[model samples]
Target: MGVDFSGPEARAALGVVAPFDMELDAELLRWLPDDVDMLMTRTPFVDDVVTVEFAREVADEGVVADGVRSVTAGRAEVVAYACTSGSFVRGRAGQESLLGVMRGAGAGEAVTTSGAIVEALQALGVRRVAVATPYVPTLSHLLDSFLGEYGVSVTGHDGLGLEQRIWEVPYAATAALIRSVDSSEAEAIVVSCTNLPTYDLIAPLEAELGKPIITANQATMWAALRRLGRRPTAPGQALADH
Candidate 1:
């Protein structure tokens, strides 16, 4: 006899439109409840280098609108543009434009990674945050500016200067980076990069560092799930816990 393929039913769904090189689909799913479904799509691939030009190209309104349209058929209640650098490289106006495009393309509710980071910070009542990223200084600075636009101060920051394959960076390296960027003034640590693997690091690092930790994938999933009127499950992660 064939195995029962329909053992469980999904209660709700969230849509995600990610960058071309995103490698964290499984990691994103780990944040969802068993009864919730995630519908994901990716923008066209670009060069391996992570740069301002690369961000601009990947964030083209036409491309993102198309991506959103492709996933809307899944009946997702909310759609998220899950690229931190791409969404913020153009600043707040550009970030808002992406939402408009996604909405124009059929997304009733939309969120971007950078936008979700801000919301996550606000939800946690955090104003001063430390940042660690796998980006060149130039790309990373854009994140600082993006946060500043919302009146959030960066207490400290450090970057690994990585251009590609961010997913391969081990937890030890990321943990060390987080430690290096942390400061007494910082209420939270922000790890910017949807491609970097951070689901397992949020809780332990929070315990050791004595602050909340918000990573790209965590914020994106949290915001999307929140919009769907459901809570994300990441056992000791501060963002999910809220």
Candidate 2:
């Protein structure tokens, strides 16, 4: 498992690398099972930049390569590139390219948060999508551009301008931000960004919003498990419902 800020339940064993500011140990300790062991990798970046260059740089060759190296060194069962926008911005071709690089670095299997989102959407038969992110407007636009390349139409998109600190964003704030979007025309809702904690809220959001809700962390976990041929025993909601 590649935990993001939102944390995960017990029964999952994984490592985490924060591409942004996130308190992983506290969050995970709250929910992680005692039997599961975890390691943390921190990749921090400054907030001042017009192009989101740091976010891109960490995702591009460095973070992915480093993450792959860590996974290989640990001999972990799986490794995932945890940023949704980072992987999607690289597009499908770029995702494959990164996966190849990860394999070369030492991972037996690799998956991206973006690819997981796509798989989750497709599993639920989602075509038209409404998206919300804690990213700035520029990165939000980049995400829209990336999703477009995957043949998923974005019916609407909203960004909270929270940037890298999105992990600290409260769940209520995220739910409220997502609720403000007009997703009636979309087949599903995508809350993009692993750093933002959205896993525990996925079920309630789906029920209230009346559409399948796919979050970055949830999708990434689901995809990585699928790669390991493991079926998540959790209840039906989000991608697990499929």
Candidate 3:
């Protein structure tokens, strides 16, 4: 076979450490720029672990380290841990632990999805935000608490309380869920679950809410590309414009 150095395989790869069976490729395809590429590895999966119990149960340092080892195997310019709840479960220390593991495992640059969201909010100059999430109230509360520690206020929250098949949520329902949590006091709105889809709704929601709209996947993708020195460009979303 001729040495093929074309398409995504030849591009600067964005390594992703996804929660097992995360169904992420569809979401990544929507949020990431076509010129770049994603190389992914999966960690151990936990069934019905989208709740507070699950969050607490799965915040193991060993699991994070193992995931890092898997994803950083290739020549990725950057590696992103792409589980929002999992990243924030043990708070910032957990986030740092994940990043440290990635770097220790030889990632050129590393970021967690939760850290990416915080960076996204800061870059947009957003202080107060409304949130839409598919997690139960306890997990949703953790999301708020995590953002609060970063100086971002959670002015509103709408938790759908779903534990399974979050990725299958339709855009219409996700849009409506966002509208339910929106507040005039919010500088931005965040859709908090990586498994919950938001790529098609970002620009429209930003326009409707009259502020920036942030989602777990979009933020992580932005952070991975930005860390590798890529600037996202989109027509409406502030995160993209940066």
The per-candidate count of clashes, in order, stands at 0, 0, 0
Error of 1 at 205 (Å): 0.7
lDDT preference between candidates 1 and 3, better one: 1
Candidate 1 local lDDT, 1-242, one digit each (tens): 99999856646878999988888899999989887888899999786599888888999999999999898977775899999999999999999999999999999899999999999999999999999999999999899999999999999999999888889999999999999999899999999999999999999999998999999999999998888888898898878767
Per-residue lDDT over 1-242 for candidate 3, one digit per residue giving the tens place of the 0 to 100 score: 99877744556678887877587577776666777777887777677657776765454657766766666666675888888998888787777777787787777788888999999999899999998898888778888888988999988899888887888889999999899988789889988877888877889888777889899999998988898778654557778777
| Candidate structures ordered by lDDT, highest first | 1, 3, 2
Candidate 2 lDDT over residue span 1-242, tens digit each: 87587745544345554465544345333333344444556555646532356556667666667866764566365677777766766567877787787777776777777888888888888888988988878777777777777788999988888644566789899988888774579988888877788766877778877888888877776777676555543354656756
Decoy 3 TM-score against native: 0.91
Instruction: State the C-alpha lDDT per candidate.
Output: 0.92, 0.70, 0.81
How does model 2 fare in lDDT? Answer: 0.70
* C-alpha TM-score for every candidate: 0.95, 0.82, 0.91
Error of 3 at 12 (Å): 0.5
Measured with C-alpha atoms, the lDDT of residue 47 in candidate 2 is: 63
User: Which candidate gets the maximum lDDT versus the true structure?
Assistant: 1
